[model samples]
Target: MSLETIIYIIFAGIIALLLALFQYFKKGKNRSKLDLFFSFLRFVTLFSVLLLIINPSFDQIELSIEKPSLVIAVDNSSSIKHLKQDDKTLGFVKSLKNNTELQEKFNVNIFTFGNQLREGDSIDFTDKQTNVHDAFKALSQIYKNTNAPTVLLTDGNQTFGNDYQFVTNSYKQPVYPIILGDTVSYTDLKIQQLNVNRYAYLKNEFPIETILVYNGSERVASTFVVYQGNQKVYSKPLNFSKQDNSKIIHFTLPANKVGVSAYRAEIKPIENEKNTINNIQNFAVEVINEKTNVAIVSDFPHPDLGALKKSIENNEQRSVSIVGVKEFVSKVNDFQLIILYQPNSKFKPVLENLKTLKKNYFTVIGTKTDLHFINNSNLGYRVDITNQKEDYQGVLNTNYSPFYIDDMGFESFPPLLSNYGGVQISQPIDVVLNKSVQNVTTNDPLLFTFEAEGRRQGVLLGENIWQWRAHSYLENQSFHEFDNFIGKFVQYLASNKKRSRLNIDFQSFYNGNSHVIIKAEVFDKNYVFDTREVLHITVKNKGSKTEKTFPLILKNNHYEVDLSGLEPAEYEFSLSTKNDKITKTGSFKILEYHVEQQFLNANAEKLQQLARNSSGTSYFINNANGIIKELLEDKRYVSVQKSSKNTIPLIDWKYLLGIIALSLSMEWFLRKYNGLI
Candidate 1:
């Protein structure tokens, strides 16, 4: 406390005593010393209350010494267990745990990891997958603030994640990686990767590129075969010397059938080749014979017509035909979707045809658009145009959830040409993009959609979408973002789907190594999305007759469950909720694919490279004990001192309050007993 505060407290005490004397002291009667002492006690009690009203507090300092953390991370994947090095690894862990030198200096944290990270020596090396990036990420989070020195023990082969070398830079601690595999050489011929599109139109040809890598081959000759199911479609001879072992072979396959096409690429294993599992790779593509035709009807020529046409044709399964109003009036019935740009009196016949056909379509209302006719039409929206033109940018609405987008480049995209208009949206609709005028976000809808009379309808009250596409390409060096948005917009408008209260989204098939996720949306009686209901799913393997039930957890706008850990087989599932009695059933297939088994040998060189990148050295399992000696002698590793501050309030002392009450009671009882009154 300062001197000024002390002086104030003393002044309060004196004033309290003076007030007590005036209130209780007798002027004409002789008072005993005991009576005077009783008056003094009352004064003190009042003075204490006055002083404490100032609310005094104090700060207490606490000091602590934290030893450096030494993390020992072990690999717990099938590759390590296959090498039969579990005994050696366990012995090394035991030695580190019992080391006295490390115990005196550092706090040791041991962990095991494969597809995931866990604490302690509870690793049986049974984890089927290895994700080295996840292990590094987990360690970085756990020991980021400490003076951490990481010791990694693994063969460093990652099967289900990005390359570990790319993810190594995120962890800042010194990485002392131990190479845990033999340096033996074996002949290997493998299909490194296969690149092909996931969808192809029937009666069209698609290209496939295969990368083949081989070692220990001296003028090897092999036959590469491509099989479509059980039928062999392409066979070619591959002859190369050992020096030119890596080759990329390209093949054009025909899509003749309208179904799921599963193809296998295989190379016959040579003699003494160790990893035969990697010699073949299987992939499937969906082939569709039915193609949706889109018709673009415009009264006059516009740049947006060409841009929109090209965007829709990005997908080979869809084709766009641009025509004038007269041509579209004759052929509008042929296209599933019709796009009208600036529909005016000249296109009145086309609009009437659209209403008669009752098909899905969209209208782009610009300055030249006939606002009077659109307002009177049954397009599910009403717009009041003021004949004022403005330039507005497209801003993405994050809450829109009809489909998924990789990214929305709204910040850097250019503005679109729009008119000053008043718009209102109706039922069964949502805004996809909002408009921003002069960089200020507004509630005006740039793009909105609604389903009416079993037809999907969309409205874009703007123009010059070609400028947006050009801006995207200039900023991102690609037109993917703009093209994707426009393409999905047309695709959604063309879809003929009935509204359902319970809807589920999942793939028909998935590879065993891929993560299997199923998403569902539930709506209430009002037909609005509601996520408060409970949904349960029962999945049964077709072959084993075993079933399991899992409850869906509420995610951001829907319910979801991860079934990635399930076995590879065809399974049937049924979903039910407590709020609704209706049950939905579906089936999916898990392909028999094990990517980890293809990595027959361990990868030791990558571990050494990672250690060098992190300013540390690599060591073998036999020399892992040197870590303790190296850390103990290093000057950079030392105990860190930490200080903490705390505050305490004075009002919590209940004993002091009790003492004041006791003094007042004793004074009253003594005065009454002695008849001092």
Candidate 2:
């Protein structure tokens, strides 16, 4: 309230009081104590109402006490037990949590993490992977902008995820990392890496690249062997004279058998090597008798050729060859399916030969494509080209189904360049993707596939597929969406199988470290998704002859089962339905490989780097008691001071209305008692 406003309010109260006194006490009639009190109540209520009309606000200061948080983050991964330090690490964690001094100074929160972070003191050491960077990142997120000091404990041997040094430096806190495990390197012979294709054609030669690493022994003399089952296929002598050396071995093996075959590459373990689990590694490659050859016949080189080729080859059963117009005539007969890229003026002879062979083809309509010529040829569809070119994106057609790829809803992906006019289809076309122009979805087919008069054809009305693949990766952090789209198209064209109500698709082989997933799609007789039933699958371990049955769960318009924790062995699977009685059978092999055991020595350098980056100190696990004493003595990481202010309006106080009502009620009672109504 200002001085002028306060003076006006006081003068108004006096005038209102005089009016009330005059109205009630004129000629001093009925002038009793009760009348005087009634007069006083009327005067007070009128003055308070006049003040409320002014509506002033005032600031209120509030005090609060906030204790700074202290985060004790511990690594509870399987690597601790593998390094023979689980008992000591557990004891240290228990002691830190029960420390009275740390509890009194700040709110100490204990957390355990491996693949993800969790709050607790239970250290089970069962996590299969360790990610030190994730632990630091989790702490930073939970204690953001607070005066928090984090204590990290680990052997610093990160098996997965990015380097921890970056997160520790950016944590904005004092980090004290208690280094565990033996820092000294031990004598060991390890298979550092085994790289092989997951699938190969029957009777074709495939290559396996193996890198053998030796660290401790100066003279590493051993025999390297590659075998499948009990039969050894290849053997060589390995020798390293230096303390550290990486020997690369490449094996060209013939895929003789037609099934999932597991190959083991091993180095004969030395007598003094303490850790020999990493000496052997298993990898599998499925050899299939049926190989689908797909050729990309192009007039000129475009980046789309490379993108399409990579995605098509993701299926081991399919092989892609990029053939130019000059060489395509001789190579077209070798391919089961052909992808014609803008059949230009030079493709007249090629198109005639394609019709003679009666082979199915997928065509792309580009700027240079002769739409008029294509209209004459029977590729199932034609487009009218104009001088003006427009950019268009794909809008998925919900009803199209020769084979289905997962849907990508309108999410603002980059557009493909098309001629301004549009496409005109004269055949029975199953349009999979429509043209979405300027945020409006049109009925024009961007891509379609149809089988007409014993000829199967697929076509898309755009180019720049390289950009589509790159955009798919940016959208979902993987090239799976683009690859699935291409793979389904190729599969539909390469094989003319009778349609089934139930279908299952999975890899024939998988690395043991990766997640083993089997996907399924079920449709009713009307060809719509059948989502009202539970699909059961019986999984049997080939070696043990034991079986386990589980129901596949539906997600994202499909059914999938995650066989993650199954043993590293060959497994046979059978899926079944209830009333329909539909059954599907398949088998897959899981290769045995453990990446964590390759390292025999603790990574002390990374732990030391984290300490230096965060302005803290490092200590061995046995000498880690200094961490608590130093943290207590350091005053830099202490509680913070904070304050807040708020402004309150007088109208918000409902008790003021209660006071007015009470005053009016009292005035009424007093007047009635004094007979002055």
Candidate 3:
């Protein structure tokens, strides 16, 4: 309390005392014991009222001891069970959590991770995949600003995601890894990796690549063979020792039949090999009979032409031919899709031929493009151009449903150059990317698609798209994402199929470890997407002669069904609507592969490196007592004394008001009873 508050309290007491004296010792008042009691009551009531009127506040201090957090992240993937360490892992975690010293010194938090991170001690060890990198990332975010040391318990075998060893650099807390599984090296022969294209042309030879590895000191000889169903198609003798332990085998197989074909590659394991499961691998490819031929017709050469050709031809089933407008006019009927690059008066003949034949074409407009010719071309759109050029960036439309396309971080791509203009479309169109200028998004289409008279047409309002491809590679170190985006657009244009009420999208082959999802879209009579329709799919296993039916759940703007429970075999499926008679049929194959069962031993070196990088120690599960001792001895993770101060009212208003009301009521009753009122 301040001096001003103290002075106010003194003055309030003096006034209360004076009022009590005046009430009892007035000029004609009698001096009696009852009068004294009444005076006392008046003094108490008056003093409380004055104190309440002042309402002074005082500072309150509180102290607490904050203990450092200790996070325990356990691996709950299937690989743990494959290595026969699930029970041992569970026992270790239970014993650690029950330790009295740990409970008293730190706040213990338990987590489990497989495909994702979850909080609990429920360790079923049934997860299909292991992602140690994601586990570390999630833990770093959860305890970013706190002193939380993590205890990672895993085999250090990640089936998917980025390398886990390098992820330790971003983590601020120390990570003590308790390695699981046997670290002993055995005489193991394994197929490290296999590479094959998804699609192959019928009657053509498709390339297959395999990498074989051996992990024994003694020299061994084996036979590497590939089988198509029950018949052996290829074989080679392989020799390996400690020095020469790896070999790359490349060969080609003929795709004589047009369907999904499954193949298995095996490296015969040497005698006394303990883990033979890693010796065989399965793969599949679809033999497609039809191929798409796309032509790029331009008046002059540009880098965009070469970029388009390379991106489109990344898939083995599609080919791109770059030709001038004069050469392309005569060969218009040879290609299914035509790409017109920066069309001007020279493209008049090409555009006329496309219009006459009702062929699909994609138009790309740039600064060099003649706006007057484009405006008079009657291509369902007109641009009122200006003499100025503008660099505009692209913003993706999340609602685009013509085909599934990811965002791919389009906002960071380099801007494209185009003439400043007001674009107007005369027909209904789907805008995939909108125009953005100077960080402000505009209601203009940068890339759009429309259909007219049974033909599809795509229009891009800018150029310099080659830079977009290069930027994508710089970001991801691969052109797969950008090329896939272009492939979807080209696939939509190359197909001459008429618009239908139902469209289905799926793959012809899937690995057993991957999810088999089929997506579908339904349209009403007027060609508008309908969300009220119900869909279902019936699948028939060709090998087992078994049938099953599943309902398709409605997702965002589409319906989908997951067939991940199906066994590895050839299967045919039919999709049908509930209210209408619309149906579509397709077939797919799932290859036999188990990624978790391929490991022979634990990855101890990477885990040790991870511990070293994070300033922690690595230990085996059987000898992990040193970790607890070290954690207890570490001085950096000690408890911190935290204090906080707050200003609070000295008197509670409720109790003060009660005291004042009780005194006033008692004094009034006493005066009335004595007939002194």
lDDT of 3 by residue, 1-677 (tens): 89999999999999998999897878464577787788889999999989988988878899999999999999998888999988889989998899999999999999999889999889999777889998888888999889998999999999988898978678889999999987898889999999999899999999999999999899999999999989999999999999999999999999999988889999998999988888989998889999989999888889999999999999878999999988898888889999999999999999889989999999999988999999998888998777999999999986665666667889999999988866999999989999999978899999999889889999999999999999999988799999999998899888877767888988998897788999898878876677899999999999988999999998867788999878889899989998887999999988888888888778999999999999888999989878888999999899999999988775764788888999999999988988878
TM-score for all predictions? 0.79, 0.82, 0.83
Q: Which stretches of candidate 3 lie over 4 Å from their true place?
A: 1-65, 299-307, 390-401, 407-417, 436-442, 466-479, 579-581, 642-677
Q: What TM-score number comes out for model 3?
A: 0.83
lDDT of every model, 2 decimals: 0.80, 0.81, 0.90
Q: Clashing residue pairs, candidate 1?
A: none
Model 2 sits at a Cα RMSD from the real structure of 4.6
Model 2 lDDT tens row, 125-187: 876677887777778887778878777888887877778886755688878888888788777
lDDT of 1 by residue, 387-488 (tens): 788887777765555543334667456777877866865565767788988788898888887877777888887898888888877866777878888877
Better of 1 and 2 by lDDT: 2
Model 1: residue 258 alpha-carbon error in angstroms:
2.4
- List residue ranges in candidate 2 displaced over 4 A: 1-68, 116-122, 134-147, 167-173, 218-220, 297-301, 314-316, 323-331, 342-360, 365-412, 419-462, 471-485, 578-580, 644-677
Which residue window of length 10 is worst by lDDT in model 1? 398-407
